[model samples]
Target: MRYSNYIGIFAGLLMIVAAVFPWISITSIDAVVTGFGSEKVTRFGMPVLMNLFMIGLTTIFFLVPKLWAKRANPFAAAINFSWALRNLLLLSTCRNGECPKTTIWLYVYFAASLILLVMSVLPDMKVIEKGKE
Candidate 1:
């Protein structure tokens, strides 16, 4: 249970790393083109920044261990989860009947963010006192 915090930290870190890699690649019959992810996309890049910011906040929470930090962790996770879900949806859906094949990094990003979400939602375990029963 003590390590639950670490689990959230690990999830956040995973997302941070995944963000650096490509999330989605566009390919055609002739050649492959640029990808769109945290790194590649410029417009509407708040998700990328938010992901990093949340992870940084998570780290700070680990160090400070404040009540506020504990309360805020779930919100951070929710944001990242929605961001990742959006990424998945946008990448997978086809607008003009031509959906590009996604790359492995996209899945990685989703999985990492999903893990972070789950970790944040998990309630802290209560420690049982010895001979209490």
Candidate 2:
């Protein structure tokens, strides 16, 4: 927990890198989907940009040495994690009896988001005793 902020920053960076790789392959359409690019039929929009914004915010919060920053970090991380899950489910789901093959980077993205959430929840901070001073 002492190094939670550093770990969280790493996770955020990993997520950013993972977003560029292929997430799934749809045999029916002979297309590959990534966070930044997806088939029009899926109508998932641009998840990569949104995720980047969220992760960037989370990383900034992690670097801020304040109680409020620590408190807000978890919220940002949770939203990023939820978005990652949404991307995973939407990209890999079967449609009209055709199931897309999930790629390794998809799972890696999800794992990094999950790790970011955990690290945010356990931010390292020093608590001062009221009477000690």
Model number with the top lDDT: 2
**Candidate 2 RMSD computed on C-alpha atoms after optimal superposition onto the true structure:** 1.5
TM-score of 2: 0.93
lDDT of 1 by residue, 8-115 (tens): 778777776766665554454432322223334354344466567767766666545556666777787788788778867866676566776666766777787777
Best by TM-score: 2
Stretches of candidate 1 above 4 Å error?
29-47, 123-133
Candidate 1 lDDT for residue 105? 69
Assess the local accuracy of residue 39 in candidate 1 as a C-alpha lDDT between 0 and 100: 38
Q: How far out, in Å, is residue 55 in model 2?
A: 0.3
Per-residue lDDT for 1-133 in model 2, tens only?
Answer: 8999999999999998998888888887788778888764456667777789999999999999999999999999999999899888878889899888989999999999999999999988998999897
Worst 10 residues of 2 by lDDT: 38-47
After aligning candidate 1 to the native by TM-score, how far in Å is the CA of 37 from where it should be?
4.8
In TM-score terms, candidate 1 sits at 0.71
TM-score of each predicted structure versus truth: 0.71, 0.93
Q: List the residue pairs that clash in candidate 2.
A: none
State residue 11's C-alpha deviation in candidate 2, in Å. 0.5
